[model samples]
Target: MTEKVLIIDDDTNLLSGIQRQFRNKFDISVAEGGEKALDMVRSEGPFAVVICDMRMPGMHGVEVLGSLKEHAPDTVRMMLTGNADQLTAIEAINEGNIFRFFTKPCPSDVLAKGIEAGLEQYRLVTAEKELLRKTLAGSVMVLTDVLSMIDTDIFGKSTRLRDWARLLAGHLKLPQPWILDLSVMLSRIGWVAIPAEVREKFKSGESLSKKENEMIQRIPETGKKWISHIPRLEPVAEIVFYQNKGFDGSGFPDDEIAGKDIPLESRVLKVLNDLAGISQDTAPTKLDFRQLDLQAQLYDPEIVQIVRQSLPKADAENRDLYFETAEVPLNLLIAGYELLSDIETKDGKLILAKHQQLTKTLLTKLRNIGEIQGIKEPIRVRKHIVRKV
Candidate 1:
């Protein structure tokens, strides 16, 4: 990727001279004043670095750079000024988060070094964000994949929720959709502590003992505890912690954080979690939001409206995949095919839940379980080659 640079100044001569002098050394774009520069940043940006003259006709450097801080926050901002007073430096640093301040007669070589430094800073900022976005999220995903081996149903539901979360978020044009996606995927991480029988009873809609109910109620906080320990996942942890919070402020943690004061992603998850519950009781293709509509006080109306429109479409998309399924025996089982029904023993004990994708770990578990308990032959599955879920 090119490390594109933008230089903003009112002097056409200076702009042209700078462009010419460093055109070979850097990728350069120039704007005569702040307004035009902002327009460029909005329309053609992801600029690696921006250097601006301190004083101009309108939208002085501090103001322009402050705006840039909002628009292209990752871009390294630097200033060149004839008035290099302490007050100017303080204001620039406070407002613009300037990377470097240069005096008016900055040598070409010195300016070159500063710009290079700014570019390096930009690279570090972006690279760290990418690591957090990809690598950190990846590590979290591996943990969830382990969850799949433990409880296929929870993992399967989370996977399904991710489909809806991404779809609804896209239709609504929400920023940072990945945050919502991660929240949905990790929504059930709290269930890791619950004994298999307790989780099963809860899933089967069996009434739980008071102690069991308390354990179940703590799932979100448990999720928050495990996830919050990771660096920079605190927002995701907050969303996980608040997934069960009611839009009308009637749910747990016993706080007054009602309505939109609840995190928006949590609101999105609240609606989606209820929808996943409803889907559990019905056909995936007929997944309904009307039940959620009746409980409007518990959800964000906007998110419910979008889910009502988008979820059936997401379900319909996978209907064809189910239509082309196959039933394979234990010896023939392979990774990447999705289970369409629960895998059980010859004696009729449930071994793995339905809607789970076969993984090497799962396949090994099935085979070992087969050797010991004898798996039922011809397990029903769909060939899952599309690389989703």
Candidate 2:
């Protein structure tokens, strides 16, 4: 756990000076130009602080800092330049998100303190992010494991779907944790509502009758019922309900949600589910599920392309963790909500519905901030069908 400091400057004298100044206090790596510096930062990091020169031949310090921010954002950036021009400093601060600006005549003590503080901040921020990632990963494992018992087939599908969902999320450049892990895990809960015969038929490429299609439509409702009761899953439940939705407003149950109005998670999941269908089915390779999904009105064209590009990469990392750990729990249906206590045991119906709505809102806000991927539409829960009393 040694703290690493990266010094990038065209001036070998200044680079050596800084390296020697901090030699006793920190571990240092030096580079003469921006390109070489960038390569170092990208490959051998977790760098604690990056000290860069503003004036250089190949790439200026500000430009180098910008690239560093993109490649290793958590690394603290400092600009060291001879020029004290206020406008240049302001621009660097705004564009490159520079942490500290040091002039050429900076005192050794002051520069040392700046580097130390920057490294401290980097350590804190990276530690927080690593903790968050671990937390999210742990929660995902628990939830996916539980889901495996809920439905073995769905567990396998969910694991595969999550692998693909992660790829789609990255392809779309989404940052939401729950959307990537939870949405894909819960996407197949709707299948729990479909009869084994219908699911087998759907998987086997058998076309269903109109009545069968309508029955299949109720799967979302079934998903909602189960999802609403799980407090931890409330946020991504809409994806479970609407992964089959159309981007052009042609998906099942509620069709009014279209384009950006649809949750991003839903849009991402739509592509994931469609691709999973293509992979699991006997469709010929290069059948272009994205084209078929968009043309058939199951997914948006934009979303389809995003999925298409990421599919190759996702396939490379598809571990099928969810599917392998998932199992058909004994008395799965009868043991609903045993793991969750925040949900109502007294007012089961009303509270569950309310919980469903709250989770949808939370997820919607998270998506708007560009934190998650999937649907671009908000899925409205359909009212229960009323038969003649």
Q: Each model's C-alpha lDDT?
A: 0.84, 0.65
Compose the digit string of candidate 1's lDDT tens values, residues 1-389.
Answer: 28999999999998999999999999999999999999999778779999999999989999999999987889999999899999999999999999999998889999999999999998898888887789866876677777887877776677667767776887876646778878888889999989999998998999999999999999999999998988777999999999999999988667999888999999988887877776652233333556666778999888777766675543545666654577889899887776778899999988887766676777888899999999988998867455467
Q: Estimate each model's TM-score.
A: 0.82, 0.52
RMSD to native for every prediction?
4.0, 14.6
TM accuracy, model 1: 0.82
- For model 1, which pairs clash? none
For candidate 2, lDDT tens digit of each residue in 1-389?
38899988898898888778778888989999999998887568768899888889989888899888887888899988898699889979997899999998889999889988998899899788777767766765666555454444445456556656665665676645555576676666666667778876875679998988888877776776787786556667776677667777776757677777777888777776666555632121346563464465656678766665656532312323211212222122121111111122222311121102122223233244332232222222212223455
Candidate 1 lowest-lDDT run of ten: 280-289
Best candidate per TM-score, number?
1
